[model samples]
Target: MKTGRRLTSYALNYKKIILVALFLLTISVGTDLAGPFIAKNIIDQHILGIESVWNETTNGKSTAEYQGEFYKKEKNFSDNEEKGKEIRILQVGTKFVFMDEKLEFDGKRTFEQGILTVQKGDEKVNYNAKVLTNKELMAFYKLEIPGIIKLLIVYFGLLVISAIFQYGQKFLLQKSANRIIQKMREDVFGQIQRLPIQYFDNLPAGKVVARITNDTEAIRELYVTVLAQFFTSAIYITGIYAALFILDVKLAAICLLLLPILYGWIILYRKFASKYNRVIRSRNSDINATINESICGMSIIQAFRREKETETEFEKLNTEHFTYQNKLLSLNALTSHNLVGVLRNLVFVAFIWYFGGLSLNPASVISLGVLYAFVDYINRLFNPVQGIVNQLANLESALVAGERVFSLMDEQGEKVSTKRIERFCGNVTFDHVSFGYKEGEYVLNDINFEAKQGQTVALVGHTGSGKSSIMNLLFRFYDCQKGKIFIDGMDIINIPRQTVRNHMGIVLQDPYLFTGTIVSNVSLGDPSISREMVEKALKDVGVDRVFKNLENGYDEPVIEKGSTLSSGQRQLISFARALAFNPAILILDEATSSIDTETEAVIQEAMDVLKKGRTTFIIAHRLSTIRNADQILVLDRGKIVERGSHEELMLLKGKYYQMYELQKGNASLAG
Candidate 1:
């Protein structure tokens, strides 16, 4: 699916809240857009209504007394009521003049010496006029005060309603946005768990962390800011255009030109912005990767005095990121506000030209109210236009971030099965097994081995001699490309990876610890393992003596990678963790290589007590460590060249014998 649709699908998960928000938004926009129309009504019907012809009336209400005659405005005269001869009240420039008789035509008006001259193009008419003092003019305006105040009250009420609804919509929209991002982050993190180990081998931890943190944050802005602004602008623009058409259709149609222009600019802006944004986001990820690598290997870098070189490398990535950001900034500067300003200017020019032409004709002249409302709407129209233009950058960024997030989600991952199986009898076999991490380059060739129930087997080899690879295959970390491996007579490939490894455990050379107490790390938060079980496992691994000096004992805190602990302490915790699971098959991959002699002896004693009734596979380089094993396999170049008990291999004087002798000589020389 496309990135947009996928993002929309996440939004749909909380559509109810969003729909409520949109409903509130519609009400808010409706109340807000009603302002100009109400002002137009007040202006035309009450404030400017004094210019209409007056009729003499006997009615007391809404009647103005002029020159001892009670007269009412034409609009105030009831239908079918008594009528009187009409007189006019007109404005001549800044002054109001009272005319007893209506003129033949009304246009440019000038009153002098009690006569009113009205001219339109080539025509002119004259009327007897009276100029009202400020006191008399006040009488005419006093009649409109109550009506104007009522309309003003209604206008203010609508504004309050608009504000309330506006607040409601914004709060609800932002809440739903936060919820959507929460669920998206959860899904992304959960997907990470389902991904295979090999997937992580190619990508840096910081890049993965960026996907979950930085990229998702950009997407959050998409829902909260970009989409919110777009929705509001869409509604606001639509409302404004509708009001414009109602005020004047021709002007509204002229405004329609802006739609295509704005759209075309967006298309053009995205063409360049998308390219720059992609590079920026990629370089951002690269920067994160570099920082992570530098932090992780800081010791080596500082020890070797490579800080200057590392700084240069990091600066290069930072510079590329900075360059693209500046490019995006330039594009935004050139387009967003400038495009809106230009469009605003163009619309205003058209508006002025159209209205100017209309003003030349007496019949085509619009009321002040209508003209005011039109200008108000034209100005309001540019607001949403500017809003949309400014948010284009965020829109593109969100789409780019969405693409990265979805691409990670799109990677093929194995479904983790929760199915459990009975423990294996610890008989493991590798039958004609051959495998390689990459195709066409075999790391293990025709490897055949059988480890029976309750037997201890040891694999001795140099680096890259397929020792760890065999254990990886056994744990189903990677399936062998050829031949079948079996555990207790069942093909391991036929079982789910989780189920296949249910009865297995491993202790690596460099043990990994999480940020928690040692007890939590050992139990791994499994409900099946109790505190007592954890303590017992720790005791069985001889961690009691090793960690006895610690304040918290088994509950002691272990930070990331157990960096605060000694290597021996970390390895012992790893051993306790494995024993807590009580796996039938255990593989210790050079578990004692990094520890001191005393710690090694403690682990060896722990192994002697823990290895009963279980098949143990030891990948060790120390020839003395596995001397008493039931079977020893000596490997070279991905093939087993010798196999037997240590003493039998020694009597044969073969490859295993040579390796043992070489190690003995090295030990003697060191002594």
Candidate 2:
């Protein structure tokens, strides 16, 4: 019922189309029933009462007989209703007349009296015919050619209207579905933008991709298929049943006996098949994530010689997907076969009842024409039954897809953007901060930091010593649990997220490049910044020579995340991107650690040029990198253990000096 309600809402938006279709279906069904009634009329009126004669001279003794013998042999009328009224013409010559007045035969001729009269040269026939029954009146209309033409016109009209409706539905369904899908994609992207950084840590990339791309697409297809197939099935079933009942009530009842069996099979299969399909969808998501991970880390996998192990892992997921898919297919096929078999059995039973009864008693009678029409009605019934079952299957799939799509649509993200704008300075401070991804086991505990405007504050720490956590708190990616972070003496929470981010620009150790011209990637997030500004930023980042070397310079296509460019070039482009924004505060989080000596020298020179006017926060392992920093803080665990200038830290011989000595020794050994 939930599924029905959801689907109904989508369909009700186009009520005009649905109503037209129903009207046409009604007309089509009526025309379809007219064929059987016509056959019955021809047998009773023309075949039975028909008598033809010929004059013959054989001997002195002559005999005259009616052609009623031929009618009896044809079994066109029942034999038990006594003989029809036979009138002999006394003239010498023989003549024949068709019963132009309609007649019904139960081995007797009957017709309407006082309405139709026959005369030969002003002498009327003496016989009075029986009155026409209501059934005979209806049968008469179908027997004639004009009535058949009327019904044919109705049938053809319905076929044309149905085809037009089908074409319109395809166009409208696709148009509406694409709009709905685009909106869903935007909603998912918006939600992820507002989510905390920890959300990404807990959720797999593959799962998110499945929800955004695959699940949303499934929901859209569900709407289209359900709209197309479900109504068609319903119309077919209704038309089939009505036609069967009109032909013979007893036969229709027998054919309908298979319905309960068909429905039971559907109910059973629908339950199991839905479950298996959901499993298959989940397994498919796992496979996609695995493939994405393997490709993204191809170098690491190859260096470790883990290709065989990765293949084994992928095979496991593939086999699971195969098993679930087969289960679904088997159940679907079983339900289809069961419904068809039951319907076939019912048809066979109806046929036997109809034929065997005719054979048993001479009084049990039906016209040859009507019997032939019933056979066609029996064939029509199967089509509607099959259509109904297939529609139900589509309905089930749509229901499942809608649930997943709505689930994503209903998710909530962090409340961050109530106010659009606020004022802020570059003075950043984190007071007694404590943070954790999970509820317990804090990664940063009781942290404290302050960076005044234009101050170069360097964080000297080992890996996992909470250097990045400080930057994360400063950027408001995750709020501190125990204390508060202030930007320009204002509570970070008071300002809009975008407002806070506007004051800071970050350069990560490993930067990403999009597939576009170099200028385009740099101009992102600040489209107002000019190409001239981008060029200046690149030159300031000491990558002007690299850009000049390229054939198209800033217009050179990066192609597949800047694969055409080296790692140093990629980093230089990212530096230019950050500089183009011209932020008040800059964060270089181990940004130069991955570069070679020559590229590092170029980056170091660029950094020296850009750091003059803006406040900078440097998180680095190389002591020489921050030797000229205005202040240095050494962190161990989550707390600051030492704070001084480079010479002061060395004089104190704390953890900073020890790490510096260790790295210096390694550098000498390499040299």
Candidate 3:
């Protein structure tokens, strides 16, 4: 799906609220656009109506008294009223003149010596006119006061209604935008969980963090600001065009030229802006990744005295990010206000030409009210135009961010299954198993092994000898490319990964702890594990002896990675966590390599007791640690070269015997 369509789908999730908001927006635009028309009515019908012809009348209402005669505007005269000779009241410059005889033609007027000369083209006519005093002019204007005041009240009322609806639409639109972003973040995070571990091996944690946070935030602005401006501008522009056409079709047709010009500019601007914005967003992700890597390896960098080098590397990424941002800024500066200003100027030029050459002629009947409304609507038209132009940058940014977000969502991921199964007796087997992280390259050769129920098997190997790889296959982190792995004689590949992992647990050489209390980390907030169960697991793993000095005991807070705790403390908590889950199969991957001797003894004692009815696989480099194993497999180059109990291997004087003797010599030399 297109990024725009995907974003629209998210919006549709809350279509009810969004549709209601759009309805309010339309009403708001309608009420606001009514202003110019109402002003036109006030100017033409009520204020300028006095200039029209008046007739002598006997009607008492709506009459202006002059020279002992009561006269009413021709428009105000009712049917069946007594009629008298028509007279005119016209403005000659700043002063009002009364003419008892109506002129044959009306044009540009000049008044002097009590005569008004009206000229149109080659025709000229004169009327004997009387200039009214301020008091007499007041009588003519007084008749319009009530009507003008009523229209003014209506105009203000419409403004109030417009404001109310405007506020409603903005509030509702923003609310729905927040809700959409909330759901999007949830989906993105859930997708991350469903993704395989290999995905994280390629993408840095910070880039993933940026996707969930920074990218989604940009999308939020898309819904709240960019779309809001676009919608409002669309409605406002449409309303203004309708009003313009009503006032004068010719001028409105001229104004229509702006639409295509604006559309073309948008297409052109996006062409350049999209390229710059993509680089900017990509660099932003790079900067995040760099910062995360720096923080995580700060100790290593400082210990090696590479701080200056690290700073230089980070500055390089930051400089690239800054350069692209400036480019985007320049693009915006060149286009936004400048484009709107140019368009505004062009429309105004057309406006002045239209009214100057065609509408302002003496023979033209176009009223001053129509001219005022036209200018008003033209000026109003640019507001929405400017709004749209200003928001173009945000629009592009949102689209790019949405594309990134949806791409992450598009990655192939396994569906997490919640189906539970009864715990099976641990009888794990690898039958002619072969696997590789990359295609056509086998990391583990065809391997065969069987670990019966409740048996403990120890794997001794150097790094890159496929020890951890074997455990990875068993846990279904990655499936074997050839052969099969089974538990209780059922092919593991046939089971859902989550369901298979349900009865398995592992502890790593470097244990990972979350940000929570020790008890919470042990139980992992699982409802099935009670506080008593957590305490019992901690006790079984000798965690209480190590953590007894702490103030909160098992409830003591553990910060990120358990950074505040000792390595031994973290490992013990990890052990407790595994014990709490009570997995049927447990793999300890070099679990004791980093521990001090005393802590190692504590873990060994706990392991001796805990290994009772569970199949345990231990990957170890310390030859002394697995001496009593029921079976010991010594692997080299992804193949098992030797296998037996420790004493049997010692008697054979083989590869295992050589490894044990080498470790013993190292220990004797250190002593």
Give the winner by lDDT: 2 or 3.
3
Q: Which lDDT value does model 2 have at 429? A: 82
Candidate 3 Cα outliers beyond 4 Å, as residue runs: 360-362
Candidate 1: regions farther than 4 A off? none
Against the hidden true structure, what lDDT does model 2 obtain?
Answer: 0.69
**Per-residue CA lDDT of candidate 3, range 1-671, in tens?**
89999999999999999999999999999999999999999999888888888998774999999988888888777687777889889999999999988767667899999999988777788889999999998888999999999999999999999999999999999999999999999999999989988888889998999899999999999999999999999999999999988888888999999999999999999999899888888888988998999998988999999999999988998899899899989999999999989988988888888777874476667788998898899889999999999999999999999999999999999888998888969999999999999898898998889999888999998789999999999998898999999999999898999999899888999999999999999999999999999999889988766776898877889999999999999999998899999999999999999888888998999999999999999999998999878888888899988888989999999888888999999999999
As for candidate 1, its clashing pairs are none
In candidate 1, what are the lDDT values of residues 1-671, reduced to their tens digit? Answer: 89999999999999999999999999999999999998998999888888887888885988888888888887777799886878888888889998878656668888889988988999888898889988988888999899899989999999999999999999999999999999999999989978987789899999998889999999999999999999999999999989988889999999999999988999999999989989989999999999999998999999999999999999999999999999999999998888899889999999889999998977796889998898888888888899999999999999999999999998988788899989999999999999999998999999998999888899998899999999989998888999899999999898998999889989999999999999999999999999999999999888877887888777788888889999999999999999999999999999999998998999999898889989999999898999879999988989998899988999999888888899999999999
In the order shown, what is each candidate's alpha-carbon RMSD? 1.4, 9.4, 1.4
| Candidate 1 vs candidate 2, lDDT winner | 1
Model 1 lDDT, full chain set: 0.91
Give residue 595's error in model 3 in angstroms: 1.1
Which RMSD does model 2 reach against the true structure?
A: 9.4
